[model samples]
Target: MGISKPSRRGFQICCGVTVILLIILATVFTILAFTVFKPKEPEITVYPQGLENITFGFEGFLNATANATIAMIVGINNRNYGSFKFKNTTGFINYRGDVVAEVPIQQSFVPARGKVNISTYANFMVDRLISNTTFWADVLAGSVNFTSVTTVRGKATVFKILKLHASVPSICDISIFIKSQSIETSCKTKLKL
Candidate 1:
């Protein structure tokens, strides 16, 4: 078929417009894919805990039989634009390089750009610690020092595009004064989420 000059020009124009529109759509899709698939980790903070609220009881005045219960609180800050689904969190209280108490975290969910408070209890017996020499020395000094390690496991989900898993650990020092019924604590938590 013999083509007219104006018809040929119109066909060229339509081809050029279609090619430009296709390139624009491809670029927009690429940008959106990168933005939606980026990964981020959640953050956790353990409050400086003074164990004053921890209850201590002894079965025998001179015996090594002691029972204790502790209340611990922590704050989780979710900075990402997603929800965090935390798994079973646990905290271990260590004294003289031994675990004295085990705490289970109560709360589980952290919303996007939100903060949450989690409370846990550690109740344990001192049967193994009674016969220890350093334990009595620390008790006689009227102050006993302890360490707590907490671990949190979770996954962050965003817009059905990204899901990143994270593990967070925290450490804190605890001191209890027998005579004053008081407690002092220092916490340094570097979350590697």
Candidate 2:
């Protein structure tokens, strides 16, 4: 008796149908990967920063423990089609190589394709700002430059459903001309998951 080849296949999906199914699955997977797993970066810009209510220290050391409130203007742009919900965010202000001030970004939800502005402020000591040799030299030279950095650690929701977690770092360079009361700002952002 010969094994009747076991009817190689009873009922099977047609080759064309199988190919179509495979294509559909592949397309769906690709879309999901790009939208759910891919990391998206939001754009950030720091407007001009101003030194307000600045007061130098007491008698002997004027620059020591200077009391001053610094105000920094920040703008965030969410370009993704999904909303970004950030929490426990923080901002850092650095002069030369040292962090002169820090602030916490209020927990909020950034809508998709939306922009939001924030005015961040922190009290920093001129003693710390002048601590950096470069900053000190610049101060003596009459030109001061600082950096404003804002970081948002949160999850991105695509189509209001898929949530992927990541951290977004936004940095801006600040040039302050104390003599002229002029300020210049430029910014850049990076996304890291």
TM-score: which candidate is best?
2
Best model per lDDT? 2
lDDT of 1: 0.72
Candidate 2 wrongly placed segments (more than 4 Å)? 1-19, 28-39, 55-64, 131-133, 140-142
Q: State residue 11's C-alpha deviation in candidate 2, in Å.
A: 4.7
Candidate 1's error at 165, in angstroms? 1.1
TM-score, prediction 1: 0.61
Residue lDDT tens for model 1, 96-165: 8888878788549888778898876665556655555799899899998888888777776777577778
Model 1: residues with Cα > 4 Å off, grouped in runs: 1-66, 79-82, 190-193
Model 2 compared with the native: what TM-score?
Answer: 0.75
Residue 141 lDDT (model 2): 77
User: Per-prediction TM-score, please?
Assistant: 0.61, 0.75
Q: What lDDT does each candidate get?
A: 0.72, 0.75
